[model samples]
Structures are given as structure tokens and as C-alpha cells.
Target: MMISSQKVKVDPRDAKLSMAHFYVAFTALALGGLAGLLQVLVRSGKVELPYGIGYYQVLTVHGVLLGLVLTTFFILGFQFAVISRTAGTLSNRARKTGWIGFWIMTIGTAMAAAMILLNEASVLFTFYAPLMAHPIFYTGLTLVVVGSWIAGGAMLTSYIRWRQHNPGKPSPLLSFMVVVNTLMWIVATIGVAATVLLQMLPWSLGLVDTIDVLISRTLFWYFGHPLVYFWLLPAYMCWYAIIPKIIGGKIFSDSLARMSFILFLLFSIPVGFHHQLMEPGIDPAWKFLQVILTFLVVIPSLMTAFSMFGTFEMYGRSQGATGLFGWLKKLPWGDARFVVPFIGMVAFIPAGAGGMVNASHQLNQVVHNTIWVTGHFHLTLATAVILTFFGISYWLVPHLTGRILTKKMNRLAIIQALTWAVGMTFMSGAMHAAGLLGAPRRSSFSTYGESAQAIEWIPYQIAQAVGGTILFIGIILVLYIFINLAFYAPKGEQEFPVGEVTDNAERTPMVFENWKLWIGITVVLILFAYTIPFIDMIQNAPPGSKGYKLW
Candidate 1:
């Protein structure tokens, strides 16, 4: 007897389920944003949440939910959009699995967030031992990460299967980036899974006497650093693939896009110790090596920035606009896709670049565990990533729903993007100042004490508080626009405008498929991995020595 097999085709434009997926991601993001608001407010003493747990729990939940869960779902949906067209019969299953993963991940993250907010598990989000939380929180988070892992699996399988059937045709640049992202996810999470399932879980269950705080942190950051790239890649992919089209130009160099993706895959993981710059027991040499790779990775990132911006210049010229960046005005500012990425770039450059400075071994000591660090991350991840997701949704959902947004709503989105960008900048600036003034992070309020004025963090704290209010208003506006788009936009009148399709879909041949790209990526990762044992050396050294081992 023979079994019958059938092929199924899913419409990429069938965004009804896509919209549901995005909403789940969006709602989680909004909750995280709310948590951020509360954190800032509570830290500034503007209001007390009355939770028994310290503010660190609130900050951790906000970071994990928004940065990890929301981003994972958003990336999953975005990846589907990029790959579905070329994925043949398996696209339907991929899309279905994507939505399933979204729901599971959202529910898990929500459960974890509720636990955090309810003051049940206040242990900070790190993998360090002796600071355990309620099992429910860890279990919820485990499910959330597991859901993302499944989504990554679906993406890899679908892309690989597509390539197998098609033969000799290279994967799309966007699809290749997704593959790299999936690879990084698998590699990074090994530590998290080992710690959570083997160490943390066992410890929480009283099966272990003590957990190795040093090894756990090492593993967590091993996951944490590259995990950042995972959040940023979709935005960067848009920067590479979608931005050029938005500007009505071909990408400056397709090779550059691929190069950047591969670089992220290789170097992104090894830089985890940069987060441990202030920690004990890590080898100085390994930290130094990571610092070097961290700096090296910046080159590809800057290449992306230049190429994407170059397209913007070309776009302006195409529109008959003149002068440097003058053509920005020629583009439709009301389009959320365009507006969000623009804001993302403007916020990312300074914040992300400054992050490299902090990533340096010595400089990290200066700003270690400071508010400045928080400000820097908020700039790239919170401000940039969230905006990109909103922008992509604006372009995608209308096409999916077959609805045209009201002209007013479009303009409001632009306003929302602008407001968010500006608000984040203001707050982030204050945080930098506060950090310099010795205002440490993970605290409910500035502990500058009676000499607060002397410490000079008070003024900056005031600025952060005010900036938080502005950010909250801007976020509310954004949520309102999306809600209206989903619920209020009349189904009959809603249609994605025509010109926008051709605006970004036209692609030139990608040049990054050759051996050169692989070699470059391999070299970077090899260099990164070579430095790992060095960190262990530092952990074994005597006190005050360069390689002192402190766990």
C-alpha cells in the first residue's frame, strides 16, 4: 500500500492570521512598554506600584517580555512574509506553525509577566544561582523560549526544503538572514537550556545543593549577547531589503547585506563576555578578545547603515529632490513602514555606536551596571526594534487585510514614530548622565542619598522622569493607531495603496552568495571562539590581578 501526499499553497497576502500574530506580539510589546513606564515612574518616585518585589523584577519582566518574546513573534511573522512566496507547498504549514508558536509564546510570556508584576518571582532575569524565583516564573519563561525555538525550527526547515526543491537558486537575502538568525538562536540557547533545565530547575526543586553562579552567568550572556542580534536582525533586514525599495533604488551592494548577516552569526555569540566586563573570575585576555570582535562587528553594521542611507539618497534623487537628505521629504512620511525605519536609524546610530564604547573591556568598567548602560540598550532595542515592528506592521497588515488606512491615521503614525524617537532620545540622554553620576541600575530610586545634588544625578533623574511621561504618551498614540487600523478601519474601504507595492519589491541580483562571504564569517567566528578559554583563565587569577577568577 502507498500513502498519498498532497501539496498545500498558502497566500502570503492572507494576513488575517498574520494580523492576529502581530497583535499578540504588539500587545506584549505594549505591556512591556507599560512596564517600562511603571519602572521609570517608580524609580523617579512619581508613583509607587505597591508591589512587594523590588523594581529589578519589573525591569527584568519588561526586558524579557518586550525584548525577547515580542521580538521573537515579530521576527517570526516577518520571516514568514519574506520566505512564504518562495517556499512552495510547505508555506501553509510554516505559516500555521508560526501562528501557533506566536500564541504559545505570547501566553507564556504573559504568564511570566503576570508573575513578575504580582510580585511572585522577583529574582532578576540572569542565570546566576542562589537568587531563585518562583518555579511558575521559570516554567513560563521556559515555555516562551521553547515556543521561539519551535518557530526557528519551522523557519529553517521551510527555507531548507524550498532550496532543495528549487536547486541551485540561492536563498533570498532576507531568507538567508533568517537562517543565520535561526542558527544563532540554536547556539545561544544551549547555555540557557542547560542552566534552566539541568541547573536552575534542579536547584529550584531542591535537587542540587548550590548552582555555579559564575558558569550560569557565562552561559546566560553567551545567550544574551547574540540574542540581541536576533532582535535586531529583522529590523536590519528591513534596512537592507525594504529600505532600498522604499527609496526607489537598488541596494548598494547585495554582498554587504549577506556579509553583515554572516558576521552577526559568527561574532554575535562570542561577545557575551562584554556583558560580564564588571564581573569576577573572567580572564582579561578573553574579554579583550571579545572587545576586539565587538569592534570588528561594528564594521558590517556601519556598512549596512551607509548602504541603506545611500539608497535614501538615491530615492531623493529619483524623486527629483536635491541636496543631502532633502529627498527625505519627497517620500511619503505618512507610511509607517518608512517612518519607523527612519526613526530606527536616527536612534540606532548614536545609541548602538555608544554601546561599542561600553563594550570595550576598560570602558565597561566605567559604566558597568550603570543607568548609562540601560540608556544605551533602550536606544537600540527598545526605541529602534519596537519602531521597526510597528512600521513593518503598518505596511504588511493593510496588504493582508485588503484595507486602506485613513489618511489621518497614517499621519498619526508618523507623529507617533517621531514622538517615540524623540522621547527615547531625551530619556536615554538623562540615563547616560545619571550613570556617569554613579546612579546604578536595577534600583527603585536614585540612591545618591543626602548628597544627591552633589552627586548630580538628581537633575538627570528629573529629565528621565519627564522623558518617560512623553514616551508614554507617544506609545499610547501608537497603540491607538494600530487598534484603530485593526478594528475601526472599514473592511470595505481598507486597501493597500498600489504604488507602495512596486516601491520596495523590485530586487536586483544579490552578490553575497560566493565563498568570500563564508570565509569572512568563518574568520570572525573562529577568532571569537578562540578567546573563550581566556575568560576562564581570568576567573582563576589572584585578586587585583588581570585574570582574577571571581564567581
Candidate 2:
């Protein structure tokens, strides 16, 4: 039987807690966006801030705030809402634990932000070892990770309680996805956790004289690629479980959706070495294996695309539209929530293709550390992930606040999405073009005494600045919409969209729900992928590098 669309109203306390998480997330978005604007302008050689804020500092702020802080807060809050509405109302103890996690994360964010602003932690978000920051910076980030762990624990506890009460029943798909994400996070973070606690934290505190850059980077990318999935899966959750309903259709296949998520859990972490394809310290054989694994992970993304198209086509035909492309016209283009995220998915098409290039050993040589890599991530993380977050915020803020998303605000949100699309197109396109022309990324200035090649980058640089300015304006509009939605909109209960399965007869396989089996396989894949390379690196490692603070 298809699951019903019933949604339990969130408890007022839970709503307040979720709102707190969102408020912090939006604040991070604003600050990071301003930093992004500064970056493009300064790099274009058009404007220079008189303040002590240098390029590296702004870059650090932009990366940490948006990439880490904003995503963490928003994901936690969205999952909380999903669990509360789908699984059951959280226990009082769980609610209390959630609040504690929030405070811990908030305090940690402040500590890290202070260090960055004071120029004590300009190591950048990558924080590649030997380019050290103050000890407090590492400590703060550790706390943030620990805080997320605590929050994940609370989510797990809630799911366990629900499972206990109802034996032999599949968990709600939304809660199931959240739990899977939580476990994936717990497993994936071990890499970065070890890197920080054993390596970076000690080295920063002067307890260690030097650290292995190769090993540290190995650990970072181990967590790093999966971290991209962590940002993505939540948006995918909405796409799989919610978007179909918004467009007047049910999910194409619940089984396929579950399997895709499970596959992601198994494959995401083991392929991190693909990011290091251009690095020499790693063996070529290991890199090739990772490149193969990287391609394997693409399967789930293709599955998602296929399922979404099928669902849209089914709905279109039901509405009497004819022809192969008729579904395109039937989609709810005017709905801010649907349209905004749909745009994000469209952006992912090229982002995913570019990723394959990055993973290719021969092809990566052209783009490594260039503006092309920066553009690729901007398309993936900045466009696909962040734009979906904006779409979620539109409905989510109102849902939590028990307020109506007024027509005027909805129109503004559509405009904001359009503006972002235009802005990112110009900026990221220019970045990719400039990269082909030998433009370096992360440089303070590109013009080196009128070198012709460097001079050729000027127009693209100007285009980037122009795009960034437009994007900043869109950010402001989104913040305004959120503020008004949370505090000033007319009070009303928001409908939580949950897409039902169209084929009720096709039950999800029991194997798809076997958590232990999936986890076991995931661990095995990770071990197989990393064991030899890590051991080889450690045993034959070169002398470690000491800290440097060039910035």
C-alpha cells in the first residue's frame, strides 16, 4: 500500500529549536556571501579593502562559514524536522540533547570564526598540514565535529525508540534516509577525526614538531569526498521524497531510491583518492583503483536522474500532455519550492560531468589547483547544494514558524533563484575559461607586470566580479524573505510534502532495508581501498614538514 500523506504537527519546542539552527545557518550564509563578494572583486584587481582583511582571510571565512558551518546547521535542522514529523515526536531527552548539540556547535563556530578574523587561522578550510593555524582553531573545529556527533546520536536514539515500538515494519523513508546519513557521517568522519586529534591538533599545540603532509591529506580526502555527499544527500532526500508530490506525482520506485542511498554509503568514502589523482606521493595503481571506484559512485546519481524523469513523465501523461517532452510543460514552474530545487538539479548535470574529468588521472593534470577546480566545486557545492538549501529554507522557515509564505515573498524567491543561476553561470564559466588559459586559483593578484597571458585573464576576472555582485544581491533578498517568513508572516500550519510510491504493488526489497549488511559492506570497501596505500605511505614516508604561515 502507498503510504499516506499525513504529517504530525511539530511540537512548539522542536519548532523553536529548528528555527535556532536555521537562524545560525542563514547568518553564516550572509557572512560567507559577503566574503565571496570581496574575493571576486579583489582578485579582479578592481577594488581593495583598506581594512586588515586580506585575500586569504576572506577566502578562509568564505570556505569555513559557507562550506562547513552553514551546511552543518541546516542539515541538522532539516533532519530534526523530518524525524519529528515522520518517525515520531522526539522524546524530551532527545529534544534536550538536540539543543545541547546546537549550543556546542554555535560556540565552536564562534571560536573558529574569531581565530580566522584575527588572522591567527588563515590556513584556509583545507588547512593542509605544515600551513598551521592556532591551536584554538583546530580545537574549535573538533568541537564542531563532536557536536554533530552528539546530534547524530540523538537522531539514532529516536529511530531506535521508534523501531522498538513497532517491530518488523520498515522505517519511514524520510527517517530511514536520515539514519543512513547519520551513520555515513559517523563512519566517514573517522578520517578527519584522526587527522585532527592525532595530527593537526597536536602539531598546532606544539606537542609535535612536524607532521606528514601525505598522510594528513590522505585522511582529509577520505572524509572530504564523503563530506560532499553529506551535503548532497539531504537535497536528494527532498528530491526523492518530496519533489514528486509537489509536482502532482508519486515517487517512481521506493526500492530504487533506498538502494541508491545505500550504494552512496558504501561507495562515497572509498573513492577519495580520486581527488588526489594529480598528487605524486600516492601510487599510480592505487589512484587508478580509486578512479574506477569514483565511476562506480556515479551510478546512484544516474539512478536519481532516471527516477525523477520517470516520475515527471508519468505525471505529465496523467495530466493529458502528449509527446516525449510534454512532461517539461507540466512541471510546476511557478512554485518557488519546486522550481528553485529543480534549477539546482539542472546545474548538477555539468557539475557531475566536470567531476569525472577531475577524477581522470590524465585529465586532472590540466585542472589541478587551477581556476577550473574552483569553478567545478562552485557549480557542485555552491550552486547545486546551496541553491537547494535556499529552496528548502523558503518552505521550511514558514513550516517551522506556523506562517504563510506570502505570494509576494514566493515571487521574490523565484527571482532570487534566477539571479543565482545567471550569476553562477557567468562566474563559473569565466573561471573554467580562465583556467584553460592558465589562470591560477587562490592567487591575490593575476596581473604580473603586464604579462600577456595574465593580461588575457582580465576580462574573465571582471566577469567573475560582476557575477559575484549579482549573487550577493540574491543572497540579500533570500535573507529578507526568510526573516519576514520567520517573524512576520501570517500564522498557519505548513503542509509537509511527502511523495508516495506510484507502484504500490512493488514493495521495497527486505535487503534494501538491511542496515547491518550495508554497513558491513561499506567498511569492507573502505578498508580494501585504503589499507595498502596508507601502510605504504607511512612505512616509506619522507621526513615530515614543519609548520609554515606564509599568509
| RMSD (CA, Å), each prediction | 5.6, 1.9
Best by lDDT: 2
lDDT of 2 by residue, 215-326 (tens): 8888999999999999999999988988888888989988888989998998899998888886767898999998898899899999999988888899999988898798
Per-model TM-score, in order, reads 0.87, 0.97
Q: Residues 414-482, candidate 1, lDDT per residue (tens digit)?
A: 888888877887799999888887678777654445464534565676678778878988878977877
Local error of candidate 2 at 242, Å?
0.5
lDDT of each: 0.70, 0.88
In model 1, the runs with Cα more than 4 Å from the true position are: 1-17, 51-54, 86-92, 321-329, 446-449, 453-455, 492-551
Best model number under TM-score:
2
